[model samples]
Target: MAVTRPLLDLVNVTAGYGQTPVLFDVDMSVAEGEIACLLGRNGVGKTTLLRSIIGLNALTSGNIYFNDADITKAPTYKRARKGIAYIPQGREIIPYLTVLDNLKMGFSASGKKAKRIPAEIYDFFPMLKEHLQRQGGLLSGGQQQQLAIARGLMCNPKIILLDEPTEGIQPSIVQEIEDTLRRINIEKGITIIVVEQKIEFARKLAQQFFIMEKGAIVEKGKTDKLADSLLHRYLAV
Candidate 1:
C-alpha cells in the first residue's frame, strides 16, 4: 500500500546532547491517525529521536516538519502549542501535585484560557476521574502512567509521542493502555508514534514498524510483514 502524507516527518535528522551525536540521519514519519512504533534495543537512540521530534534535543543537522510546517528550530513550547504532545519514558508526573493539577499543567502551553478538563480525555481514562484530588505520587504505577497520558490528552494534541508506556507496569495495565491507545486512534483519530522496547507491545499496536540499531533505521515495513529474524536481530530477548 502507498504511504500517506505524513502528519509528522523527520528528514535526515541528526541530533544529540552536547558533543555526542546519538541519532544519525534518522528519517521517519507518522501518518495521520496511524499508530507507528519505533522499536529497538536499549541505547539505539529511540528516546533521542522522540526528543528531537519534540524539540527537546537540538538537531545538529536536518529538519523536522509537522503538519507540513518546518519545526526544526521551534522551541519546546512552540512544538507543544502546535499540537504535539510527548509522554517521555519515565511517566514523569509531578509527584507533589494533585492528579487534576498534573493534567492542568499540560494545558500550560495551550496559549488559551480554558477551564475544566476535556470530557473526552476523562472518557478515555475514566480511572482518573475518581483520583482527581489524589496526589500524583500517591498513585500506583499504572495510575501514574494513565495520568501521564491523560495529561497529554489535555493538550488536545493532534499527535502523541509515547515512550514505552508498557515499561515497568503490570501486565493488566499494559493491556488497558493498549486498549486506550487504540480507542484514541480509532475514535479520536489522533496520530500516535510510540517508542517501545517490547516487541510484542509494539507489534500489537503499530500499523507500521521501524527498527532502530545504533541510532539508525535498520529495517521498516508494515507490521504484518515484519520478519521474525529481523525481530531477533534487532530486539532479541
Candidate 2:
C-alpha cells in the first residue's frame, strides 16, 4: 500500500548535539502513505534521525523536504504545524493531565480552527474514549503508548515519526499497536517513520526499511528484500 511519490526526503543530513555529530550524511525518503522503519542496534543513531525529521535536532549540513518544501532550518513547532507529528520515546504524555486534555493539547501544534476532538479519534481508540477523565499517568504502558499515538493524530498529521513504540509493552499490546499502525496508514493515509529495535515487528509493519550503523545509513531497500544477513551484520548485539 505504499505510494510512489516521496512525502519526506532527507538528503545528506548530518545532525547532532552541540559540537558532537550523531547522524552522518544520512539520506532517506518515505513515500507517501508508506510505513518505513528505521532499524539499528543501540547507539547507532536511529533516534537522532527521527529527531532530525521532527526538527528537534538541527542539521549541521543537509536539506529536508516535506510536501516539496525545504524545511531543514525550520523550528520544531513550525515543523509540527507543517504536518509532522513526532511521538518520542517513553510515550511522554503529560502525567497529571486527563487523557482528554492530553489529546486537546495537540491543537497547539495543528492551528486548526476546530477545537473539538474529532469523533474519529475515539473511533480509533475506544479505550481512551472510555477513560477520557482518567489521568494520563494512570494508564498502562501500552495504553499510554496508544494515547501518545492518538495525541499525534489529533493534529491530522501527514506523517508520524514514532520512536521505540514497542519497547516496554506486552506481546498482545504489541500486536495491537502494529495492527493499529497499519490501519492508520491504510485508512488515514498517514506516512509513518518508526524507529524500532524488534526485527519481527519491523519486518511485519514496514514496507520500506533503513538500517543504520555508527551514525550513517549502511543499508536500505523494500522490506521484502531485506536479507537476514544484513540484520545479522548490523543488528546483532
Q: Candidate 2: where are CA atoms >4 Å away?
A: 1-5
lDDT of 1 by residue, 1-237 (tens): 854558998899998889988889988887889899999999999999998888899999999999878999999989999999999999999999999999899878677666888888889999999999999999999889999999898878899999999889999999999999999989989999999877888888999999999999989989989889998888896
TM-scores for every candidate against the unseen true structure? 0.96, 0.96
lDDT of each: 0.90, 0.92
Candidate 1, backbone clash total = 0
Model 1 Cα shift for residue 35 (angstroms): 0.5
Q: Which regions of candidate 1 deviate over 4 angstroms?
A: 1-5
What TM value does model 1 have? Answer: 0.96
**lDDT measured at residue 68 in model 1 versus the true structure, 0 to 100:** 78
